[model samples]
Target: MNCHQAYEALQGLIDNSLNKKELVEIKTHVRNCPACKAEYRALKMVAEGLDRMPLYETSPGFNKEVFRRLGLEYKPQRRPAWQSLAMAAGLSLSVFWLTALAAALPTLLMGAKAYKLTQWLHHPELILPSFQSAILKSGLAAYQTLGFAAKVAGWLLKSSALPTQMAVAGLLALVLVFITMRFFRPQTSL
Candidate 1:
């Protein structure tokens, strides 16, 4: 809002480039300050005059002509394909690091108490966890897969006739039984 700042923003005000807050502050300053007001009026009039000037069409070779006069060839810069991908990946990693830093800042500055607060980070359920059964759960998950299979076998024997379950088991266990009986026959002989 100072005279210097007002002068600096005068061109921006004419060009419509200053942001809302800055535009308001500079406009207010210009309204109050006589010198800034005169400067603004001068710049605004020049800008308006330039805007009113007629546009002229140039030949297609104008750019080449200009470059020729300057003794240079006009080759536009070409960006590498990986440049944009690397920039995007860098930005994503930066955001992740910034977020991680924000989260760990509290723990880094001051000690966090109550192990319960950070317990979830430690007890990472890699595959599964047991369900506490107040539950109407029918399915068993893989927390103890082999144990559940044994439980299912015991249930089949108790609930159904032995021969029926045994027949199915016998067919399914063909490869498994062969592997076990053949592989361990030596140890059993001893």
Candidate 2:
């Protein structure tokens, strides 16, 4: 590591929190850079001094006394049983809904497909003209397919089941976003 990196990792080095590679790199940098070596020594001394400092125990009544001095009651708050039960029930209900959604998802998707098919069967004009022409003109095929998909999507969005489908899709999207954020988030430590 360079002097700056070595300097930044000094606390990690003192606490033995660095990996083997980083420890080796910082040690090498600190050995060569006189300024960094001095800084490392100072930090190490301070850490050692702190380790050697005596610990004083507080009396059991310390918290009570402080609260009394502040003219406040020293009460440790306790949550009621019903609040815990309500939270657990809410969590259980959420899981149940998600599970039910998972189970019903295929059926809902099939219904959507059926809607498009029915729309085509009833209103033949809504269906795209043969792609055989589109095939002959390769450049137009993608545009034609996109147009057809957009038409079907518009129809689906206008259907009576639109609200339910949107809600399910929204929930799934939120869950995916949350999962991505939770797993890929940056982690830091002292």
Candidate 3:
């Protein structure tokens, strides 16, 4: 065998994994070639030293301590059940109030009338007339605007090439998906 082939097979030879014919070939090469012989001896010495070296034992909680030092140890806190329930209730109520206010915003703005807490509490009927008028005006405005928007949309849809536009939009959306995936995909070692 050539020096390169013999060198490559040296590990198998040392481990006694080579067949009898391959072993004989490698042995003959090592015996004849001073450079190959030196390399074989060095590799054999390293293997023997490694085998004879003492095995190491880590201290208890070594991994935990290492992770702690690296600032990666995670500890979760426990809270009382009542506190958790209260927090959830508060969040839900806040979201509900915000949504209600948003839905009533146009009417409220159009009404431009403020009511005192005492007056609302004493006579809620007094507030209804102004509020109802505001809601009616705002609804009519919204309806008109919606009709105009629908007309514009219908014109565009009728005037354009629907299939071609849809195909181009699909292609653009696919390209964007591909770009986002490429940008966010995890990197791997070569």
Candidate 4:
């Protein structure tokens, strides 16, 4: 019924889809209002211009080209069976050799050290007061290390049992409550 309503209904009017009552109201308003009449004419011109523009057509084989690039119908290429088997065998051999070398290294070093210790004990010239002092210090270190390890182990054992005990007790309580509710609770009629 005003310039504002005519502007809002301009698109619907140009599209020829406005209801009868709305069309009548718009027409009456446009007839009396110059601003609304101009706005309606502008909207109609814009719609007509859009309709007159040329539409573009898509090229043929566009979808097939897209699917081909995406590998939709293509089978995956697999590595040769012998190559896979060789890789697995090489990995296994490397792992086995690594583990065997690790196992042998400590024994070999210990044997070499034992041979040097035996030769030093046999030679009175090489045995000195500093060697005795070093041995004493190493023994003291071992005792201290053992004491610290025992303390850590005792603390871990006490804490580990507590958490498991509490967890089991809580789980048992939950199970008991669930069973009591399932068997003893009354059913309510809907």
Candidate 5:
């Protein structure tokens, strides 16, 4: 193994996680390479120092006290049953009033404009010109813009090299998506 490979394997060697074959290769490389040997010594010393440090113990209720200091404790509130019932009753009354108003709407409108409503209903053509002209103008404008866009897209699709270009673009997009997914993937242990 080279110095680079030995350095990469140094952590595994220090943690005693390397298999026999890799262990031998890394040990030989580290012994032969002065830089790698020094790096290994420094890492080993740090690991040993960490292992030698004393572990501290916390007193009972320590977590609860910490959470209390941080103001994260949950306090439950109890509300009276009558308050809930009153809210429900208010909501039901409001819904009933709305429904009754909706049911009486046609009758109210008929009383206000019975002649004009009847004329429009009998002769539907009378309603068309007032509403249709504005809608047709807007629809024509939209159709013109959409038609221009469709023509441009059709021209691009008709080009002889478009298939090759699309294939290359698709491959690039797939590669970018794969790289993004790998970069943002959550780390989990087996």
Candidate 6:
């Protein structure tokens, strides 16, 4: 198998998720490709290091202090698994959406540049240049115009992106506030 395939399968092979035949194939690829082997080793070390880390416990009276602040008296409630999951899911979804939107910025800029360059190329005066020097001069002018237009377009696009980024930041902040209120809101009773 090629390095690309080997890299993709590295996780599965390391985790022993693959059958013997597939494992042997991946192992062979790793043996032959030193780069893949080194990458695999680094990833394995990171995974192992994470696995070996110790779990931490909150200090005693943490829950009492939280409930006291919320003025809530402890009455056992059903598991809050859904709340935690919902918070994580909301954060993940927002991040994904924002990332996808941001990723479109470059494509948008390229499209604008291409469209402007086409317009510059097809201008009537530019097409009428008869001599080589005239044509060269026209082409140079078009290049400069294209550069200027692209700069303006880029500035406008960048300005537009600012509001989007701010909105995303505000949304993230609001989510953080809401999560803190729900999770650490002072309990109603002491």
Candidate 1: lDDT of 75? 75
Instruction: Give a tens-digit lDDT track for model 6, residues 17-46.
Output: 998888999989889889999999998998
Clashes of each: 0, 0, 0, 0, 0, 9
Model 4 has an lDDT value of 0.57
Error of 6 at 115 (Å): 97
lDDT of every model, 2 decimals: 0.57, 0.61, 0.60, 0.57, 0.59, 0.62
The RMSD of every model to the true structure, in order and in angstroms, is 29.2, 18.1, 21.8, 29.5, 21.7, 20.2
lDDT (Cα, 0-100) at 175 in candidate 1: 37
lDDT of residue 68 for candidate 1: 90
Worst 10 residues of 2 by lDDT: 134-143
In candidate 1, the residue pairs with backbone N, CA or C atoms under 3 Å apart (3 or more residues apart, or in different chains) clash, namely none
Write the residue-wise lDDT of candidate 5 on 66-110 in tens digits.
788999984545567876665565554444333333332443446
* Per-residue error (Å), model 5, residue 10: 0.5
lDDT (Cα, tens digit) per residue for candidate 2, span 1-190: 7777888999899999999898888888888899999999999999999987665656767888999999998996577888666656655444544444443344456865754554333333344465543332332333244334434555767753544554645464456555544543444332
Best by lDDT: 6
Measured by TM-score, how close is model 5 to the native structure? 0.32
List ranges where model 6 is wrong by over 4 Å. Answer: 65-190
How much does candidate 1 score in TM-score? 0.30
Summarize candidate 1's per-residue lDDT along 39-88 as a digit string, tens digits: 99999999999987665556657788889999998875566777666555
Better of 1 and 5 by TM-score: 5
Error of 4 at 31 (Å): 2.1
- Rank list by TM-score: 4, 6, 5, 2, 3, 1
Q: Residue 164 CA error for candidate 6 (Å)?
A: 74
Which structure is stronger by TM-score: 2 or 5? 5
lDDT of 2: 0.61
Q: Which portions of model 3 miss their true places by more than 4 Å?
A: 60-190
| Candidate 6 clashes between residue pairs 3 or more apart in a chain or in different chains | 69-186, 70-186, 70-187, 71-187, 71-188, 71-189, 72-187, 72-188, 72-189
